[model samples]
Target: MTAVQGFVRQIDLPQIHDPRGDLTFVEGGKHIPFEIRRVYYLYNVPVDAERGGHAHRELEQVVFALSGSFRIKIDDGREKSEYWLRDPRKGLYINRLVWREMDSFSQGAVCMVLASHRYDEGDYYRNYDDFLAAIRVAAE
Candidate 1:
């Protein structure tokens, strides 16, 4: 996997193959860089629907496509990168202070997000301009 923005990278989870079915598991601080505190999944999304348009102040996340696929665009103040997630055993780890936008979801796509912190509206920089401004201040 390639690195992105010096903070984002692809994390490969441990997969067990069996005659019954394949199994994958994630252990916080082991499979990912941060401890997981919250878990959420998005499904039944329209093919043209878009999600995520913000950056977190202190929250880090690892997103996995449990089923189907989607595209995620990430930017770190300076550089931007995109990833197409389809495999259930791989995830995109995004650190705090990075902006992310998700779209181009395939039909029946399922996006699962493992967050390092609980949901906090105050922790979100929903506006791109404001996120960039915060990035500048953090860089100073």
Candidate 2:
């Protein structure tokens, strides 16, 4: 495990096997570290594209790629790290105030995000340069 400055957590779940296929489920208190208030998925996206280039002020999130694969870049106003999510049973838990970006999505990739709070525009930091500057200042 990598040492990240902020409160991002990664959890690998146990995958259940079946004769038909595989099954993986994350309940509110089981696989997820936080209570889930919102659930959404992103798919049919183009290649060489990026999404979620922002930081949340108070909302915590757990991102998982249920189908194919994708790469997530996370920064915590001090250090940064990148994670490649390819398995359905693995999740990346991002704490509040951490900037995240999702990119390099493979074909048929389905990215699912579980949030601790509902949608609020005020919780996001959408500017990349501002995020970098804030990190630089915090490190000093």
Query: Each model's RMSD to truth, in Å?
Result: 2.7, 3.3
Q: Over 4 Å off in model 1, which ranges?
A: 1-6
> How far out, in Å, is residue 136 in model 2?
8.4
User: Per-residue lDDT for 1-140 in model 1, tens only?
Assistant: 22233388899999999999999999998888878899999999999988999998888899999999999999998999999999999999998888998999998999999998999999999999999999888777
lDDT scores of the candidates, listed in order: 0.90, 0.83
When summed lDDT is taken over every stretch of 10 residues in candidate 1, the lowest stretch is 1-10
Q: Judged by lDDT against the true structure, how good is candidate 2?
A: 0.83
lDDT of 2 at 16: 86
Return the top candidate by TM-score: 1
Candidate 2 segments exceeding 4 Å error: 1-5, 129-140
**TM-scores for candidates 1 onward, in order:** 0.94, 0.86
Residue 52 Cα positional deviation in candidate 1, in Å, after optimal superposition: 0.3
